[model samples]
Structure formats: C-alpha cells, structure tokens
Target: MYVALFESSHGAVLQPLDESGLATGEARDVGASGLAAAVAELEAGHPRWVWDDTSRWYPRLLAEGVRIERCVDLRLSHAILRNSALTASSTLARSAASSWDRAAPETVELTADAALFDFDGPAQLNSAEDTLAEFALQRAAIAGAADPARLGLLLAAESAGALVAAEILYAGLPWREDVHDAILARHLGPRPAPGVRPAKLQAVLERLREALDAPTLNPDSPPELLKALARAGLIVRSTRSWELKKLTHPSIEPLLEYKKLARLLSANGWHWLDTNVRHGRFHPEYVPGGVVTGRWASKGGGGALQLPKQIRSAVVADPGWKLVVADASQLEPRILAALSGDRGMAEAGAAGDLYAGIVASGAVATRDQAKVAMLGAMYGATTGESGRLMPALTRAYPRAIGLVETAARAGEKGEIVSTRLGRSSPPPGPVWRTSQSEAYGEGATDADVSRARGQARSWGRFTRNFVVQGSAAEWALCWMATLRGTLDELGDGAWLTDSPHLVFFMHDEVVVHCPADAAASVEAAVRESAAQAGRLLFGAAPVTFPLTVAVVDDYGQAK
Candidate 1:
C-alpha cells in the first residue's frame, strides 16, 4: 500500500492508493499539530509514505520521535527516471520538461519553531492530487524500464539514502569543542583575533622572511611569495606543494608549514567552531545523490567532507557511549572485481586488502606497483610509472581492466555508459560536442583535432571512474540502509533518536554512536551490512567487501 502525502492549505493531506496506484480513498486533511499523530496511526499498516521531498517532511517527524520505516521520495525518484537510459522510452522520460525538472529547493535547517508543513505558501507541486499524479508517472516509468528490478532497487536505495541524510542531520555528529580548541592551540598556538595571525603562524612567517632574506615577505600572497622564492634561487613554476617540495631551500619548510596552518585556520578554525557546531553537535547539511556518481555532498558546516586529520579527535562520542567507526577496505577495486565478474580480481579482493592480494598473485612487483597499476587502469593513466605498470595489470585482470577500458573508449566516442545498476552517465555537454564536430568537419585545423582528442581523453578519465565510483556509492547506500534497519531492531522499545544510531558517514566510513554495551552489536552489524550490500548488488559474485571496524571513544583512534 502507498500513502501519498502533500502539503495543502489545511496542512498535510494524505491519500491512500492501491498497489496499482489508483486512488482507494478520499484524502484526509491533518493540521500541522496533528500530523505526527496521524502519521503514527498510518505506520501500523506499513504503507510506504510517498512525499515530494523527504528532507522537507521527514526531519520534523524525526524531531517529534516518529520514524517511518519506508518512503518514496518522489523528487529523487523523478530525477533518476527522467535521465535513466533504461526508462528513456517511458512516457515520463519523453514528456516535456516541467517544474518537476527544476532543481530541488535549497535545504534549510529545521528549527523547533518552524511549522510542521507550510500550508499558506506559494502554490507549487505539493498538492495531494499533484503528488498522486507524479507517483503514478514514476511507477509507470519504472515498470516500463528495460530492467525494472534493477531500476527499482536504485530508486529504493536512493530514497533510503534521503531518509538517512535527514536522520544523520537530526542526530548530529558528536563533537567536542574543547578538544577542537586544544588541537588548534597546540598546532597553531592560541586563536588569534580576527585579521591577525596565530602565534605559531606568525613565528613561521618570521622564519620564512629571514630564510628568504625578503624582510617583508607575505606568505599569504601567492605572487609575492613566488617572487620571493625566485629571489632566493628556488626557480619554481608554481607554488603548489608538490612542486615546492622538489626545491631545497631554507624557506621551503616554513613556507609549507605556513600554507598548511593558514588552510586550517581559514577552513576550520574558531570561527568555524562558532558557526557549525551547536549544542555539542555538528549538523552538516548532507545532500543525498549530490554528486554525479551518487556520493553525498555537504553544503555547509565547515568542510564536512574534508574533515582534517588534525581535528578528528574532536569527533568524540558522548559520555558512556562509544563510536563505532568502520570503513570498507579497498571498496572501489573490489567493486570493479564484482562488476566485471573477474574471478582473479575477486579472489585477490577476497583477502581484505586487494593491493596486497595483487602483489601475492604476482600481478605487479610490489604493493605500491599494484596500487599504481590498478589506479592507472581505472583512471586512464597513460604515462610514467603508472602507465609502465598497466600492461602487467591488464594481463592479470583482463576482465576488470577491460571493463574500464571499454568505458573510456565509449566516453572518447561521446557515448553514454551506465553503472552496474543502470545509472547512466550524462552525454557530453555542448562544448565537448562542438569541439568534436569542429575537429571532424571540413577544413578542420590540426590544433583543433589535437585539442579535441585531449578533451576526449580527459572526459574518458572521468567516465572510466564513474562506473566504479557510482556502483560503490550504491553499495554504500545499501550498507547504510541495512545498518539502519539493524540498529532500529536492536533499539526496539527505546527512543531511537536518543539510542544507539548512526551519527556520521563519509564516503566509505561510518561512525555510529552507541552505548558501550552495544558496541559489539554495532560492529557486527557493520560487517554484516557490508556483506549484505555486496550480495544485494552482485549476487553470487565471489568478491568480498570487507570492513575495518574499530570501537573507540574518539573517532581519531579508529585507525
């Protein structure tokens, strides 16, 4: 059964629909104050709640301690089906663009004072009738897809991810401001006032100026620093760390230190602490399906995706609880093995560390060589050590390497490639199409053809990684979804919002804050979820997705 929900003039309106998506009953108008109670009553029937946007409707319910088991996020589902190659022939895909194709509304932080659902807002697609219509279109599109089951699974996983995003935001990551301040003070010295450098940064700047003999060198000024470096006889083309490291100069060390500290101060210093962290929680706004490869992207909260190792200690669990930090080991390579059905590659990944297994198989001379070769194979590397090692890797894991090679070739030809579960890559943009046409048409210049080839290879590198990355993201969604269900079952009879639940999720790593007693259960659930995700995506495939799980009070102690 499906229950379609929409915000109307009265509040939230819910209408029940049969399995075939036909209306089964009249719509019920529930006021803002009664929404939670009405949803709680509907939960007894296990109906999949269909809503226009999960982030808008779900967070308030979660705040009220109402957790729905399943939902159909129509907005997310619409984006997938409209662009999916498998559903291209469906009416939904063929229909002219409407407001449905518009970008999602900007995500906003939900406060306690905010209304449950806006009833008197400007008219949009939140009417009960409009939601029912969109739901029917999505269902029809999925039903008419080439591989409906796979597309359906993708939709289910994506929707589950939406729920998890909302939940993770509500139950913000456990953060310790004191620890963060300590880390900052230790590394950069006491936090300096606005527009002034910290003690350690000032000290480094003094040393840098003396070393370069510039007296008034400003490390923050890139062009000025470049001139200073040249004057000191370190002729470098760029000030990039990798390039700078190649030069030996008294100023080099302090310069690098200055850059590192400056980044820390600018990206996640005291100001960041004041703005992002609230009430011992870091509420990062996670955008589900944000990346083209399906990875989650964070919009705010101080570089949530790029948390520096220098401050990870601040991600401490609450008192009397533990943080279960688990990351899938060699996720992408293992995903490649499964997707390509490469038995050799699968066997190599089965041992937990795919790179070590590759070395053991004599695919490459050393672990580093194996790593470079595999990355080259996936990323279209065609020069230097990676390129030199590619032939050996290709010979050893033909299917796995060949799969990426095929994707690269397709990309070079401006063809679209789909991931394992049917998320197709978007076609080349107008610029790329124009370049290729210019290169191939009459009277084309040699430079035009050369430029076009370079662009093609650049895009090829992207597409080559897209399939593996996108599929790995799907696996992650499944992993989190399975773990969420497991945690809910384990927390039965307890208020889940205050019980053991997921608090943080990076690309492959997840941190669960739970009572110390539940650490073992959570660890077990993490491992089980990895295996389940593998089975769900690639049934009977020999590849294994192993997780390195650590139970610790501080997230930094996990590894």
Candidate 2:
C-alpha cells in the first residue's frame, strides 16, 4: 500500500507516537530506511498522524490505500472532506457553506447582503434617482415643476437621497455622522421635514410623465449627486426650502460630473450589495486602511462618508428598522490636543468646544470665522478668502501653525515627518524633487516660474497637513484592531447576526451597519473603542477626547 503524510488544515504540525501513545522523538534517527520505512516502523510503534501539507497525502493515497497505523497519538484536522460518492461530497460542501454563513460576523456578511433582495428606496438607490426627483420637485414647487423631465429628476433625487440617508444612519460611525451633521448645520439649519417615502423605482418614462405636472417641489438635486457635490463644497441651500444654488466653482463642474458618475456607479453597487447580504441583512465590507490619507473605505459599496447635508436623506433604514446614529463633537481639534500635548488645547476640548476657545483667545469674531481660519491654516490655503483671514489664527495658535508650517517646510525638502507616536509618512518620490527645483530653478526667471515656485511652496503646506492626516490614520488603524478584539469577546450569541457591520471608514470616523436591535450595543462599542483608542495612541498623556453622538431615525437627522 502507498502512504503519504498530509498537512493539517489549521496549520498544525503532527509528530509520530509510540505504542504507549507517547511522542517518539527519534524519527530522524531511523531515516536510513527513508520516509517509507520510518512510517512502517512508526506504525509498528504506534500509528502516528503527522501534519504536513495535504499534497503529500493525496498523491500516495491515490495509488493505493496506506497500511493501517496503530498509533494512539493523533491530532484533529478540519480539512474539507471528500467522499467516495459524488453526491455525498456535494452534500458535505453544502453543509460547510451553511456553517460558514452562520458563523460569519455581521461585518463580513454585509459584503454579500446588497444582492439578495431589492429593498428599493431613497437609501437603497443611486444618486441620479434622488437628485433627479428633488430637482423635478423643486422646479415644480418653485419654477412651477413645469418641465416634466426636470421634475422627474427632482423627485427621483429626493427618493434616492432619502434611501441613502437611511443606509448611512444605519451603518456609519458616530464621529463620522457628527462631522457630517456639523457640515450640514453650517449651511442648512435643520433637515427639511420628511417629504416623501420611497417606493419601488418607477419606469423612466412614467417618472418623466409624473414629473411634468407635479405639484410639490424641492430645489435640492437627487441625494446621491447632492452628496458628491456637497463633499466638494459645491452646493448650499438658501433659506427657502425650494431655493438652492451651486457654490463650487463652475470650472470644476467636470469634477462634479465625475462625482455624479460615481453616484451613478453606486446604483449597480447598491444592487451588488443587496445581493451579497446573507439572508436578508446587507453588510458592506469596511476596509480599515482603505483611504490613502487615513480615511475609511467601503469594500462592497462606497456609502457617502465625505458628503454634506440633504443628501444624507438618501441613506435610509430597512423595513422594521430604525437608525441609531452617534457622532463625535470636534474630533480633529481634540485629536490635535492629544497630539501636541498642549494644556490649553486639551482644556479647550474639555470645555465642550474648540471654536469657543478661539473666540476666548480673541482669534476671530464668530465660530464660523474661526472654522475658516483653522481649516485654512491646516490646509495651507492662503491666496483666497481663507488665506486672507489666516494671520489672526496664526497669531493666536502659533504653536499649531508652527507645527504644520515646520512640517510643510520639511516636506518641501523631501523629508519625512513623524507624529508624536513615531508613525511617519512614506518618503517623497523623485517627481517631488524635480517639481520643486523646476519651480525655483535659476534657469527659469519668467513670471510663470515664479508662480510655479509659489505653487510648489503651497504644496509644501499641503504636505504638512498630510503628515498629521496620515498619522491620524495610523491611530485609527490601531483603534480598529483593538475594537475588533474587544467585540469578538462579546461572543456571537450575544449580538444580532444581521446587524450593521463595519461598512465604511473615513479619517477619524467609522461606519457600522447593524440592525435596529443592536444600535445600543453599537453605540457602547464605539464609545468604548474611542476611549480605548485614545489610551492606545496617547498613553499617560493628559488629554481628554470626547465623541459627539446622535441617534437618528434617519440619515438626514444624523447629518
């Protein structure tokens, strides 16, 4: 009989055993007989089951069945089994599939959730539907919804927006939701009253026909498009519900269209997502190191984590589900506190808000100005309005500015910058050096060269922020690993299987898609993770970090 040793599936090593069921440490000593004779001797001693790659076992067994070994010592291997009968193997494989499905965590399962069934709604559809619907509605309401095609677009937009908002509220991290909401509050005071519930998507012709003379109107484009535009800071709403205007530069409209295309792509994405959801629950995969700049990336679908208000309405909860949302208050500024070890900054964060500190510091007249100034400083945006307003900020928070500026300068020199925790960015490529020299090269004395040099200088400022942003990403990664471990201990039985899993992550934000029943646990898990993340990133440091959380029934509310 032919014999071969097979490796265990779990990667364990097996050794020979004696008749007494004890390890015979001397297999190498009797090796003159080679592996075959040694195996026979081991069978005489006691049948020893050795773990090795299964490739070894399959070949020898294919020729003939191996002689029986009497070794009592053995280990269990969980390899996929093949039966004599084809029908039997198929049944075994089916059973294995069911077992894996049942044991898979909610986060992992979301990858498969998007496909199974169609829960078509504002939250579930693409940006085109919501934007088109809202545009049609607004045109009808304001411009009289006279144009059927435009009106159709508006209503479609609204429907899509509402559905997307529902999904976001259901999946996003608390701090991420807070940042989104803050951006919304900056422009739209509060969410518009829930306008219309989403139903099955209408045929294109019928939608166009209905929009022709629709009575109701809303100015906002479809939710998905609006979200893409808002993130790029292109659109803002006026006081009236039906009044909306574009804020971003017209030159960037192509970029806007690209975003729209992305939104459109999300339609197919939504379909794929639903199909992937195991059973009835969709779980979008959350990639921890997804963003190049330390933000979260969605594996199965890109739920809009970067977008602004109104669009959030597109993300909706499923049937029999309510969104439980929470967001952190002033997360970045608070992170700065822990990073710099500045007592004043920490105190400012501890006192509820950071803009208030800027006001108290006499940095700016209102919180809005403070926001523009601080953001401008970090981004190194100095030429436009934000740049003009930056002096006062640099004067007040010299250290903050100093930190970014110093890093920016080092980056211009093509050097790596490190955060407090020792995480460093990758080295600048050769392109950076060539670009820097070309801009400031003595050979080029024209005005264009000077401008180029200035632009390069500006890029240096951006590099400074990249260091901070990138390091912040590392902190997020550490937090994710820690939280995953903690939640695993909660045991599978204690948690709902179809609940929200980690669907998306952005720098300093995380999105969890869970069922309504698990929202409480989700919130607790986030808060605990944030706390734990702080400890891990800043040990023994006197810093206080607080996350602003809001539980919303809709993504719009969370926004």
Candidate 3:
C-alpha cells in the first residue's frame, strides 16, 4: 500500500486515502485502523507514525514519478522538521503547548519497495550537530563580544530588535517561522560587557513613564513602546549608577537575561563558553547563491560578509588569522547589464558604481535618486516618488529598462521567462490569470485590480530579475564546485573546506568561515569563483564583474 503524508499550505499533516493505496484508482470502505493495523502487524509493534498516508501528499507524489531524493537521513530530517515545528503555526504552537505538558514521542517507520535506509545514523547526527554548533559559534564571533555572557545578551537584543522590525516592516504578510528564527540567529555573536537584564529594562521603562507623568498606560504595551520612548528622548535617565552607557544599565537587564536564555538554546548539544575550543578566532559560514539574485548567506554569524561599516567590532581574529572579504559592487545592475545586453548599463558598470554613473550621465540627480528611478522603470512603479523620478533613468539606461519592461509585460500576459541556464519560470496558473484579468478588466472602478496588476508587473520584474539572478546563482554554484575541486587537489593540510565551509546564501554576496591559514587561498577561491561565474554566465561578454575586496577581523566591518 502506498501510505502517504502530505503537508497542507498551512503545513498541517493531511492524509488522504482511498480504500487501498491508490489516490484515484479504487474506493473501499475501511477504517483508519486497517492500514494502521496492517503496518503495526508488519512492523511487529505499534510503529509511531511520524507522518503517514493520511498526513502528507508529497510522499505519495513519488508514485506519480515526481522525482525527489533524500538529502539527509530521517533523524536529520526530523531535526530540521522539528525546527520548523517550533514556529510552524503560532496557533499550532499554542495548541501543542496546551496539548502536551511534556514532549511527545514522534516516530516514523516505512517499508518501501524501492529502498529502506536508516536515516538516523551516527555520522549524520554528529555532522548535523557539528554544523549547527559551528553555525552558532560563527554568529557569536561576528556579534563582537568574546565572552559568553556578552554574546548571549547581544543575541537576545538582536533577536528582539529583529522581531520588532519584522512586525513593523511587513505588518500584514504571512510570516514563516524559519525565516524569523534565521533572522534572529543571524547576528547573535557577542556583545560588550555588563549586559542589561530584561526585567530591569522593564522596570526602568516603568520608572521613566512615571517620571514623564504618563504612568497611566496599558499593561500590555509592547517592549517596542519603551524603545520608542527611549528614541523619542522622553526616557532620558540611564539605569546604570556608574559611568557605563545606557546599554550597560540595570534597565537593559531583561534583554541580557533573554540573551542568556538564547545562549542556552543555541548551545544545544555543545560545550559551554569559557572552555569551548573557539578561542578568539571568529570564523563565519559562507553560503553562495543564497539570495534570489545570487547573493550569499552566513550560516550562523551575522552577515559578516556584508556587515554594516560601524558594526565590525565583533570579529576579532586570532593571533594568526585575518578576514579577507570581497563583494561584487553593483552586482544586480551588472547582472542586468549582461542579461539585457545593454551597452549603456554595461558602460555604467564599467565606469564604476551604476548609481554614480547614472548620476554622472545626467540620468538622475544623485545616486540615491538613481536607485528609485531604475527600480521604478524596471518594475513599472508608476506611483509615488518613484513614478515622478523614473522617466529620466529609463531614458538614460534604455537597454536595461527595455529588458525589465519587456519581462514585466510578459509576466502580465501570463508568460514564462527563463534564466540563461534553463531555469524557466513556470507559467502563472488560473489564479494568476484570473487575478490579472480582474486587475485589467474594462469599466473596473476598484483599484484592487490595478493593485493586483502592479503585483503581476512586479512578478514580471522579479522573473526578469530572476533570470539574471538565477543565472548568477548557477555561476556561484559552478564557482563553489570549482573551488571545492581545487581545494581537493591542494590536499587536506594546505586547504580545507571545513573553515571556509559553504553554509548560508542570499543574493549578491558570499560569506566564508575560514581558519587563518586558509584565509588567503579562500580569498583567491572567492575571486576565482566570481571570475568563473562571469565565464559561466556570459561566455564572452566585454564587461567583467569585479568584486570590491575588504579584509576585516570582524564581520561588522565588511558591510
């Protein structure tokens, strides 16, 4: 019987069954216990169904020849899957909390005609744990503080700040918990000494409110309220009695405590701070082609490869170690140049910064203005300030503008676009078609349709961008492949993948977590990869993409 489990859009386990294993073949009146009973008998025990035929449809999809190979064992899958569960559905989390005071046993057993392999093996478990640990450590190093206490606090603050930011930035959008967790985990490395406590921070805020004569407040006010008060200059007094700044005060204590808790959570299956082998060396994970537009990802460390300039304080190298960072400036624009075969855009990139060139070419008033202009032209952003400013940019960068505009039109018409390397976009289905028609329908007074059209336009813009971005991703993949091969030739002693391991990815950048000795070679590998990416994408284009290089002891400086 083809027992299957499928995940709903909401990620709930859905098990759809006919009397037998087939989804559309035959129907038999049978209870859930029939298959359960049979499987139980076959396994000779009550096999804990982690997920079964009634739970998910993706597994059963294999029967229809939807090819998918397992990347890790069941145990590793369980871990990743469990991680997903922690934030799966907010409602579900609450429900799970109420349903089980203790952890529930989750198990799965399956007998397939193809192959039966043990997923929860020792090597896989160890490897996964190590990966997680390394990721955690790399983040800690990037955050600045060397000691565990400070690191914990930094992590907590960053997480809290990000949670607040996400709520503010995308108020109505559905949030993915994994995205939240990853964002929270990104910059949690280290902090300066004498971290504040979360509770104390609260008390300080209360006192500040009392001082301001605004004591009559809702008890359920968000922590961001206090932050706002602080920003507004109403909460002026520092909680610290000494010369230490506001960050080191008793009021910030709760934030610190939260950090300590986060540290504990992060330190799962690993050693504690003082005695841990990570002594002063700050190594960050590098993920190439992580972003939708061929950027990079940092595994655990904050985006050390692309950290903001002022925050480079965290990554202090060991005695012999140095950070060597390289970034492709105006990458997206350059990719646009190649994709569109735009001489103007290519010349702009060749001259230097695309934005600067736009300004110099009299395309826009300033570099910042050029951004809004170009973005507006490509995506058909004909509203707000962008609409007012984009015409000149389009006139100046005609080829590039034409490329994205064409793509946008194609997307609006429900057409597919492809990356250079066969990564064709799937056509918009009935929903998209209906939405577009609704958006462009005659005699339509409602702006919802227009708004939807704009969205469709943006998707076209995205698809257009994706062709360049996805192709760039292919290039990055090739670079990584080449780098890995090259490192293999250098032997384990001279070079290693463990340090500059590929961990995280986003669009337009790369981060490499590396040992001291491997830094230079890794730098070379990075450059070579960029060159390789160029070769892979353009074959023989006149414009060569150059990565502006920087070497820093800390990740914060790289940005």
Clashes of each: 0, 99, 51
- Ordered by TM-score, highest first, the candidates read 1, 2, 3
Listed in order, each prediction's TM-score against the native is: 0.94, 0.51, 0.50
- In candidate 3, how many Å is residue 240 off? 29
Candidate 2 per-residue lDDT, tens place, 451-525, comes to: 656645645664577656645654565554444444434425333224444544444555555567767776788
**Candidates' lDDT values, in order?**
0.85, 0.44, 0.44
List, residue by residue over 1-559, the lDDT tens digit for candidate 3: 2222322333322222222222433323234324333333323331112221111222233223221111111221222122221222323222322111212212111111101111211221123223233233233332332233322322222222222122112111111233223333343322223443233334544654554345553223445445544654536343232321344333344333333344433442012222221433323333222232333333443332443332234334434545555667767667777877888777777776878877887877888888887666644568888888867767877777787777767765666665544333435556556666776677665786766766566556555555565555555545554554444344353323233443222345544545677777877877887787677667687566787665556555576
Query: RMSD in angstroms, all models?
Result: 5.6, 21.4, 18.4
- Score residue 488 of candidate 2 by CA lDDT: 39
Looking at model 1, residue 531 earns an lDDT score of: 93
Error of 1 at 468 (Å): 0.5
Q: How displaced is residue 267 in candidate 3, in Å?
A: 15
Better of 1 and 2 by TM-score: 1
Would you list the clashing residue pairs of candidate 1? Answer: none
lDDT at position 182, candidate 2? 42
Between candidates 1 and 3, the one scoring higher on TM-score is 1
